[model samples]
Target: MTMRYDPHIPDRELVQLADAELPAVRSSEARVHLENCVTCRARQDELERARERFFSARSEEFAAQVPAVDSSAALLRARMAGLASEREVPGFWSGRHRAALAGLAAILVLAAGVAWWMDGYRRYPLKPDANLTPGATLSVSREQLCSAPEADGLRVIPAALAGEVFHSYGIRGPKPRNYEVDYLITPALGGATDVRNLWPQPYSRGAWNARVKDALEDRLRTLVCRGAIDLYTAQREISTDWIAAYRKYFHTGTPLPEHARFFKDRPWE
Candidate 1:
């Protein structure tokens, strides 16, 4: 005999039954009722058939509208969709952009450290030592240095060596134009030719330079030869600290000697 389903079953419960959304007890009860209730069973079957027709028609319309998929991409995406686990990749040393950023950071840190260390490095207007002049080791007689028509025993260094020395002293800027690599004491005053005597001296903003020192050297030598100042006093004063001597002779810090007027009378002065 053709059996009936329950007539009292709600239309919502009938839809829920078709969708498999009812709880176990309710679903079992619905199954028992559906076996005997003909009207409700017929309604559920109609809803299921309508759902299938709707989906099939829409899927056919979508397929007609879209471009066809590449076979390889379809296969690859099918395989990827089946994968249950996923792993994340990080941007690290492997990535060029990340690596470049890391390298820039390292360089910045190194520059900061260098700046911090260099902050403590010795600065200038250097203090003069009283006992030893760096260049005053008299390899020759006082007569040879003092009486010679020109400077004696001053070594003329090659440009390459001069560049090396300038860089070694941490002096930077433009080349020979900005600096004069000169004797600490001029070779005319018993200064030696080695590195000890050679240093880079900057010319003053206006008149004073290595040339002015040449005049001072001549003046000192003149005073020494004339017995106005003893040769030892001249040598000691020039070598121990020539700038201090320059100040002393020029300063009205004490009474100026009558001989000091000779400097003012020079052609350039």
Candidate 2:
């Protein structure tokens, strides 16, 4: 039999469903509910649309950024020629020295593979987990968010709330030096100061790290205040995918030069 339909599914569960992270049985039940209930189906459709927008925008952006095949082939030829010369070196592969060198090569290859995997896996949280951080915001009007004097700097997240964010993200031990607890929707744009809006964004693990996102937040705030874009639109763009928003606003596939130079890989204090 299908599940009861008295109460609506919680948003957290729906988010998990949207992300395809829910357990099989629970996912099946949610799908059944969605098929039967218009309200839940509509909410599910909205979440799917957001995901579609991110995927569609990201695919288009990366397609335009791909390097030319001829350039890649030329680089490969140069590397292969260098390898050939190294292999022809006299006595380079002799006896015990060869064995030692082989072992070292194996270790180096393993190390490189692990580093590549990690860089691909955790270079940065490309997107915050929707179930954990769906973005939160203050109930402020555009005038309040804009007309008010900007703070001298970012406000310090409360120790308690910071701890909560770490716990929610399943992070253990001391906070990593390369990550910053940042808002999904920045406070400058009226984001709330809650754990739900906060995440441990990598500081400099990749080109699209916290520093790059900071530039986007600043630009969006400026555009909103100047009436160039609606406040809600600014919030949605950043909240959905700041990198996509960055590309859209800056009209560049990569972070601007000034933004790239703005912050170094400094350890978080």
Candidate 3:
């Protein structure tokens, strides 16, 4: 049975009812009331259409305001003016001024890195030390020899098997100037016989002699091991004719005197 409903309720309340908040039976009753009441139904339709038109117009207006090129130019001018006012300074430079400075700093850093790399490459030239053969001659100046701390007071000459060795006895410096060591072999024994010990003094005595002996032993061992010479055969040859070899090779042609001797007949085990 259709029941008569109230007609005096506000259009606002009718709008809420039209939103489907009522129970099924109440919503059916409200629908019947809406059909009969033309005034309230017309008000609800007008509200819905007005809301749609207002939103559609606002969306179009917002779309028009979005920046094209001309709008961007206007925005840029406004931003510049805003920045100048915020800084309280007239004709203030903007972000565009810093671009050149940033570019210049990057260029300087790149140049410095390139220069550093070039300097390192120049200082350390790539060359092989092993390519220098034993017989390869070198002409060095007197200044160069004297200036070198390691070779100071010692002569620099091309002779076979002349080398240095570090030992516990240590080096006695201020060693006589221009006197150089030489290596000579005995023909009778097919190996190294003598090592020329040249100095600007008489023979080394007592403690100095012991020190010299130790130095010579150390030097011989170094030559055998590091220089890759035949250890046993060289020792045997040196023992046999070391004194004679020293006198003949070192003292024969030179005015400088020979000062030391090979201590044992066979020093190596």
Best by TM-score: 2
Candidate 1 ranges beyond 4 A from true positions: 1-133, 152-155, 205-209, 251-269
Cα distance off (Å), candidate 3, residue 179: 97
Candidates 2 and 3 compared by TM-score, better number: 2
True lDDT of residue 88, candidate 2: 58
TM-score order of candidates, top first: 2, 1, 3
Q: Which stretches of candidate 3 lie over 4 Å from their true place?
A: 1-9, 17-26, 64-269
Off by over 4 Å in 2: 1-124, 175-177, 263-268
Tell me how far the alpha carbon of residue 199 in candidate 2 is from the true structure, in angstroms, after superposition: 0.5
lDDT of each: 0.54, 0.74, 0.37
Which lDDT tens digits does candidate 2 get at residues 1-269? 99877667788888898767899999999899888999998887787678668866787778678763333434444445445545655684677776566555545555555565544443356667778889998999999988887761557777788778777766666445667788899888899988889887876566887888877888898999999899899989898878778987875679887896554223344
Candidate 3 at residue 35, lDDT? 83
Pairs that collide, model 2: none
lDDT of 3: 0.37
- For residue 168, model 2's alpha carbon misses the true position, in angstroms, by 2.3
Query: What is the overall TM-score of model 1 with all chains considered together?
Result: 0.40
Pairing residues by index, what is the TM-score of model 3?
0.20
